[model samples]
Target: MIYLQLFIVFFQIGLFSIGGGLAAIPLIQEQIVDTHAWLSISEFTDLITIAQMTPGPIAINSATFIGIRLAGFAGAVVATLAFITPSVILVMTLAYIYNRHKQLDAVQALLNSLKPAIVAFIASAGISILQTALVDTSQLPGAPFDYVALVLFILAFICLRKTKFDPILIMLSTGLVGGMIYLIL
Candidate 1:
């Protein structure tokens, strides 16, 4: 029963999450954390961090993690297959349609219209992650904000926007710095 539910939930996510893996974060959060009550917000945030740090798409990584947490190895397989199935079908269909109508004005217009919506989805995911990453005001009484995380975020943003450094290198460096800081403090 739980496996069935996981399949349906991830199937929906894969079907409707239009802008790739990162864009699926908001939907996955809603379903896994809010709807199913499977994982807490902090757990979801940590899942995202792990997903981002590893190979492959964030959506697949998240599905595997959540499934394992819920029901172990078999659950992970089911969830991953469910998450990818819709994308496989959709991509094949879209590829055929796109190839056939590459020069059609309507096709071009439809593609253009989708770009903004994709951007919106990505932005929504970013905001959701941001809320989790930053200090939660409703935390313990008089708890201080996560200044270190904030500083790292700011530096990362600047590095991404201003420099030509590779993002993976930046992430690794920040992870090292963050770990050291936590150890020292």
Candidate 2:
């Protein structure tokens, strides 16, 4: 039953996520945190930090991490397979069709519709991350509310608005600040 659930849950993510692994974060959170109750919100935040530190796709790292935490080695294997299989199939099929019908109206329409869905998926992912990262200003946790986090978020936003700095650098700096805030105090 657990294996089946893992497959179906990740299969849904694969089917819907248009952009890629980062865009799959909301679905991962929905399954691992909200639906399965497999990890605490804090743990999920930590797992995301760990995932970013690693060298692969964030979604794959998350599936493996969360699955192992939930049900050990076998769970990681099942979850990893579930996360990739549908996506592989869909991408292969789409590539074949796109090669054959590069000028078709339906293909063009599909690509057009895909743009907004991908944006929506990424937006959903951002919202899920925000839910874990932000604390209610009313309820302080030990080290006062993270004004530093808010400032970093604003700085990242401004940098994105004006400059063309690499996004990975922004994330790394924020992660560093977050780690310092969580650990130092």
Q: Which stretches of candidate 1 lie over 4 Å from their true place?
A: 95-185
Highest-scoring model, TM-score: 1
Worst 10 residues of 1 by lDDT: 135-144
lDDT of 1 at 52: 94
Candidates in order, TM-scores: namely: 0.53, 0.51
Clashing pairs in 2: none
lDDT of 2 by residue, 49-138 (tens): 898789899988988887787768988888888888887897899899899998999989989989999999999999877655565645
**What TM-score should be assigned to candidate 1?**
0.53
What is the per-residue lDDT of model 1 for residues 43-87, given as tens digits with 9 covering 90 to 100? 999999999999999889999999998989988998999999997
Whole-model lDDT values for every prediction: 0.92, 0.82
